[model samples]
Target chain A: MPDPTSSPTLTVDSAAPNPAPNPAPNEASNETLGRFNFLAVIGRIILAFFQQVGRLSMFTASAVSHCVRPPFFPRQLLGQMVEIGYYSLPVVGLTTIFSGMVLALQSYTGFARFSAEGAVATVVVISITRELGPVLAGLMVAGRVGAAMAAEVGTMRVTEQIDALTTLSTNPMKYLVVPRLVAACLMLPCLVLVGDVIGVYGGYLIGVNKLDFNAASYIQNTWDYLETLDVVSGLVKAAVFGFLIALMGCYMGYNSRGGAQGVGVSVRNAVVSASILILISNYMITELFFAQ
Target chain B: MSASPPKIALSGVKKRFGRKVVLDGIDLEVAPRESVVIIGGSGTGKSVTLKCVLGLLKPDAGSIKVDGEEVVGLGDRARERINTKFGMLFQSAALFDSLTVWENVAFGLIQGHKMARRKAREKAIEKLAQVGLGADVADLSPSELSGGMQKRVGLARAIADDPEIIFFDEPTTGLDPIMADVINDLIVKCVKEVGATALSITHDIASARKIGDRIAMLYHGKLIWVGPAATVLDSGNPYVDQFVHGRADGPIQMELRG
Candidate 1:
């Protein structure tokens, strides 16, 4: 008799034939089924995309709702502002200056052929203020800040720190996401403004030093052609891009599952999605402001 | 006046993650100032049940009452108000690494209660002392502390508000045997000192016997046995006996999946 404490053993039927006789036929059938389900696969992908968008919309709405409520964490907000805005200055400035310099040089090469070298300064300032400054700064901040937020918040989610906050009578959205959202919204514009100045200075450097244009003329050309609307539109784009970057990072991180691999995936998704949204929204905003 | 109801009561609690049922028909009660421990093997819905009580995860169907008030579908503000009465010690300590020890301990006090930082820090330091931590450790980041110290700091944080109810999730997990016992002792001491109702979930039989007044054994998402801590070893149920004695050969079989 089997020991009463031991788990019962399963008895196999030795006389039964093996069930793998038609493996080749099974493989053919599976291949045929997979080929027939191509549309079903695409349909599933579309459904998943819409589901993700719906979830993100709800998350954004909830975060925005929490923003106007009381129990505001001023300290946390200031900390995020300093992180998302102040610490990001060096990289944003560097990217915009280099971009402006490259644009001025390229414009000079193209415009010199048309006997319009004077337009090089105009092109640099317009591109920098209305397009390059905000776009480049937004992308740089997304890569720097978005990935970090995703990784940090994703780690917190996996480790149960987010749930800990909830049990402590703290709303994770208000305590975590709102401060980040607010800071990113307020700070990205400032970064873009600073970046615009540096970018114009970079173009001025290239125009005067490399292209043999008079320094005063280059400055005057930039100032004459640069419209208030150009800079304002760029700043507005910066704010929107800021919201997208933070929202994507927070959303991806907040929902991260599994473990370190999950956090890694979230970071990648946050950076990629934020960059794409920044580019797409940049075009939309540019169309809104400058389209005839 | 109606006699004071249980601090926490759950009836017919059920939860599932996709196709896998983590909890099924869980029923439990902890009276005022009483300590109840749910002992279960790994993956037995211990944490899920605790989370349902904390409103971190909603049950698919159930009635969860706190102070005889139905809390199952309460609004966010109402849930937050109810949560003010709770303190939890996570299995891994889960201290916010961004904050210092005192700041971590005083987080709920400052952020939740809106207590002044100075006063909250004082309270945090006092609670830390109760958990046998020194003032010097207060300024250090949570990453700076050892696992045992982190658990102690976590305990200190849990009792910082002197909450009416405290939940300890796998209180002795990831510690050496001696350190585990030390934490178990501190848990008993702290729960008594604060006069708080305690609901702890752990697979550590020693911890259950030491810290729990009443012990409930959970198996396959249900309570298989519940008895006074002193009588747990003699529960007479094969599942409970298998768990309490830590036996490999028994009715309880490990579900090993690829």
Candidate 2:
């Protein structure tokens, strides 16, 4: 089976211009290819990339501005909160739990060779809280919430419901986009916090039962080494990831054109963009918080 | 005193998507409480014209005036103010599936006008009744309704605010002939009862005759012929004749692409 996580990116990239543009027939006929045409194609690709970045940045700025503006929709925001946060908890929790368990087992085996098996609990707790919990939760939510937001909004766009909202004297940005952004930003941190606890507990389960470590000592070691900054940084990363996820989904959906195929492309784009941004920003945020 | 300005007017309007020009310079006017229908083949920019007037799509050039106020390039706040005076019934009814029939109808009142929910519900039921829908239909989701019923609910929502102007986009495009006539009749009744100026776009000649006071034919991005609805058959414009009589052979040729 195709990996569900990377499938969206594959579809979106297929829709985009071929990464290696096919050689033109006339150019292929010429043994010595003209350098200018190749440069022109490269230049066009670079320009298109920058153009898309500019558009997305503007959309993000507008959505963020609307999040702080008046005429807020508390009910809509709450509805999105439930959708993004409550509905995503199980998947995030399961992923983090397995990840923590596996990390503990791998670290225990490595540390056993060095006669340092006691470090397994500390390693699991630190990794889960500092990096894995937020990153995993972010990716999972991007798959679930981001894809759903894009599909729903994209369908609304194609069906003229967004235009209908405009004609009804409601700003589509404020009515649709802002609530999702606010909900994601506020809720992702909460999800990361919960996932962090569940993940540490998962490590504890493996350390105590599967690995012949004392339960109390494992718990004590986890608490002794995991610092407050670790959790705080992870939550911070979660917030940024949440914002980008919601922004990409809304931007792709709002600009969706054509019809059903357009909506499918948008759904794929939302998941792909959100996943890449989550990974990139995770590193940047970690550097910001921990780099010397 | 200067004569009151047309309820809505467009002059020298132009819109092009990429290289294809959908609307070339176009001019038209709808006097107060006048029902004007623009007839055109699919893809001839009838919807684009409505979108431009509704500020959903911005024209590339020229002026669009609503109640004598130039709306082109207006900011969101100004556009919102302009939209409050208008309502639209989309071709698909475009009801919010997330909201019930009553909530959809009361959306503008509650969200835009900030009316109390209880009062808005009462008014929504009243409007639904006006469209011949019973109170029981108010709480059901729009998805549960049949196409004709959805169109009725759409009409009810469009007139809920008693807007000064209402737009009906392809009001009968997908309906059976009988249902289309019913919708057309409701449109006429609602527009007349609300005393709202009406602007509609459709290819249905029977609907055009029933709902429009004046009919204009759009061909090749321009209003090729415009006159009273009764005189459409006698307009003497070949394009109008070809379209009205549904002739396969005409001066207007379809752009067939392989």
Q: After superposition on all CA atoms, what RMSD does each candidate show versus the true structure?
A: 5.0, 6.9
TM-score of chain B of each: 0.97, 0.98
Listed per model in order, the count of residue pairs whose N, CA or C atoms clash below 3 Å is 0, 0
Per-residue CA lDDT of model 2 for A1-292, tens digit only, reads 6799999998898877664576576466564556566987899999999999999989988888887888899999999999999999999999999999999999998999999999999999899999999999999999999999999999999999999999999999999999999999999999999999999989988888899999889988999998999999999999999998999899999999989999999999999999999999999998999999
TM-score of chain B of 2: 0.98
Q: Please give the lDDT score at residue B192 for candidate 2.
A: 95
Quote model 1's TM-score for chain B: 0.97
Reference-based TM-score, model 2:
0.93
Q: What lDDT does candidate 2 reach at residue A146? A: 93
lDDT tens readout by residue for model 1, A1-292: 6565552332233323344566788888889889868988999999999999999999999999999988798899999999999999999999989998999999999998999999999999999999899999999999999999999999999999999999899999998999999999999999999999999889888888888999988888988998899899999999999999999999999999999999999999999999999999988988998899
Compose the digit string of candidate 2's lDDT tens values, residues B186-250: 99999999999999999999999999999999988999998999999888999999999999899
Best by TM-score: 1
Encode model 1's per-residue lDDT on B1-258: one tens digit a residue.
127778899999999999999889998888899899999888889999999999988999989999888999899999999999999999989999899999999999998888999999999999999999999999999999999999999999999999999999999999999999999999999999999999999999999999999999889999988889999998899999998899999999998861
